[model samples]
Structure formats: C-alpha cells, structure tokens
Target: MALEIHNITFDCADSRGLATFWAGLLGWNVYYDDDPEVVVAPSYPNPGMGLLFIPVPEGKTAKNRVHLDVAPDEGTRDEAVERAVAAGATVTGDHRKDDGTGWVTLLDPEGNEFCIERGAAERGPRTSTAYRIG
Candidate 1:
C-alpha cells in the first residue's frame, strides 16, 4: 500500500494563533480551532490539505529546513514584497536579480521562511537535475 500526504504540520507555540496567521495568509478559513490545538483546512465536505499547529517553547532561530516559496498573485515580485511587509511579514533579505531572475525570501510573523518569486519565474522554463530511469 502507498501513503498519501493529507497535510503539513508546523510546530508552534500557539496552535490557534499560528493557525490564525496561516488562515489569514492563505485566505483559508479555520477548519478547527481551540485553545491548545488548531487544524487549518479540514477536509469537511471534501478532502483537504492539512496545516497543523502544535505548541512548543523556544522561538525560532537560524534557518528553516523547509520553507514555503510563494510568488505574487498580482503585480511584480517587488509589489508582492511590499504587500507581504504590510501583512506583518519580516524581510529576511532581497535577492532580486538585475534581469528579474531572482526572488525574495520572507519570514512570517513567527519567523518562518518563505519565498516569493515573480510570476514569470513561476511559469518560466525550469531546469531539472532529474535522471531518466530505464
């Protein structure tokens, strides 16, 4: 038998709070929310992707192993950066290229790293390192 991924869980200090942040960012409603735990994006009437939040101490430090990379839904990458900054996300750094071949990496209100690439890059040609298996 094979396994399927239902959701992605994030270890956080407050499940409900963090879930609120994500729900706002993703425009997704709260699937389930309480004091200690929160499950965003419940399957409900249909299947759903999980965005779980669990409580933990210690604030985030250093880099994240897994980060969310997002491009702007409207306007250019720079515009998106402004929007993100306005949304309470911190600017980790700016890596835009002269030729517009780069993206901006951002940190959430809780210090989670996520990237925003231009729509062009999102749809541009991709270079793969995959090898065909015969």
Candidate 2:
C-alpha cells in the first residue's frame, strides 16, 4: 500500500483570508468556506492535495518549520514574487544570484513562510544545491 498527501493544513488566525491568499497565489479556487475552516485547491469537484486552513486562537510566533516552495507555470520568478506581494505577502528575503538563480522567501498574510523559485520554463539543469539556500 502507498500513501499520498491529501492536504497541507495550516493553523491560522483567519481561515478564509489565508485560504483566499493561497488560492490567488496558486491560481486555485476556494472549494469550501466555513467558519474556522477553509479549503483551496486547483478545482472543486476533484480537489487534489488541497490546502486546508483552520482558525487558531493564537497568532504565529516563530518561523515555520515546514514551508512551501512554489514556481510559476507561465511566468518568471520575479513576476511571481510581485504577484505574491500584491496578494498580501511580505518579502522576507531575496536570494537571487548575479547570474539570475535562487529563490525569494515571503510570508503570507498570517505569517506562514513560502518561497518562489524559478519557473519551469526558466529552470535549466539543476546541478547542485547552490540555489537552494536563501
């Protein structure tokens, strides 16, 4: 038997707001929107590996131990970063190299960390972890 990831859950202060931020960032749609819990995915009928946001009384106090690394499907990394910033994300670090390699780290509206890396069309052969560190 094999197991697959069904959802990546986030404990946040505002479930709907956080889910909306993620849905816009990932070009997904909010499938479920109920108080204290909201879900965002690529689709509704068959939402594969959705992002689930649940309300918590407390706010984030520290850096996230696990974070998401995303890439654009049809744009550059900088463009993606710009979109994220417009969607209520704050840039925490910019790690792009002189040769145009690396990722940008940002915090979501609720302070959850995520990264924007080179898009599929822009990435070449990844030889080492030189671009992984930020």
Candidate 3:
C-alpha cells in the first residue's frame, strides 16, 4: 500500500482570508469556503496536493519551522517578490546575493514565512558544466 498527500493545511485566525491570499499567490481557485475552513486547489479532480485553511484560536507567535518556497512560472524573481509585497506580504529577510542567486524570505498576512526564488527564465543558462572522473 502507498500513501499520497491530499492537502497542506494551515491553522489560521481567518481561514477564508488566508486561503484567499494563498489562492491569489498561487493562481489557484477556491473550492470551498465556509466559516471555519477554506480549501483551495488547482481544479476539480486535481491530482496534486491542495491547500486548506482552518481556523485556530491562537495567533502565530514565533517563526515557522516549515515554509513554502515559490518560484515564478513566467516572470522574474523580483517581479514575484514585488507582487507578493503588493499583496500584503512583508519582507522578513532579503537573502538575494549580488551574483543574482539566493532567495528572499517573506511573511504572509498572517506572518507565515515563505521564500521567493529565481524563475527558470531569470536563471538563464548554466555557465559551467559538471564532469565525473573515476
């Protein structure tokens, strides 16, 4: 037997709001939205994992041990970061390197940390090649 992941749930103060933010960020659609919970996924009959937001009594007090790292599907890293900021995300740390590498850490509306990395187009082509020697 094998197990498969269904959804990644986030315990939040406002499930609908958090789910809205995530849905907008990921360009996913909200499948369900009730008082205590909200579910967002790519589409009906989606084969991949979805996001579920559940209401919680407590607020986030410390840093998140687990976080999501996002890469743009069409634009540059800077563009994605800017969009996130515009959507109410706060920049917690800027880890981008001068060499155009590294990622930026950001806190979502509820203070959940996530990262933005360079997109495939922004990274361009590899400058060096790897070789194996025995």
Say which candidate scores most in lDDT. Answer: 2
Whole-model Cα lDDT per candidate? 0.75, 0.91, 0.88
TM-score of each: 0.76, 0.90, 0.87
Q: Model 2 over residues 1-134: C-alpha lDDT tens digits? A: 66999999999988888999999999899866345688999976888899999888888998899999999999799999999999899999999999988999999998899999999788976667655543
What shift in Å separates residue 134 of candidate 2 from its native position after superposition? 30
Listed per candidate, the RMSD to the true structure in angstroms reads: 3.1, 4.4, 4.0
- Global CA lDDT computed for model 1: 0.75
After superposition, candidate 3 runs with Cα above 4 Å error: 33-35, 124-134
Which stretch of 10 consecutive residues in model 1 shows the poorest summed lDDT? 41-50
TM-score: model 2 vs. ground truth: 0.90
| Over 4 Å off, model 1 | 120-134
Rank order (by lDDT, best first): 2, 3, 1
Ranking by TM-score: 2, 3, 1
User: After TM-score superposition, what is the CA distance of residue 80 in candidate 1 from its true location, in Å?
Assistant: 2.5
User: On residues 1-134, what C-alpha lDDT tens digit does candidate 1 reach at each position?
Assistant: 66787778788876777787777666566766346767777346564676878788887777899887877565677877787787888887889877767888888778888888887545576676888775
Provide the global lDDT of candidate 3 against the true structure. Answer: 0.88
Which prediction has more favorable TM-score, 1 or 2?
2
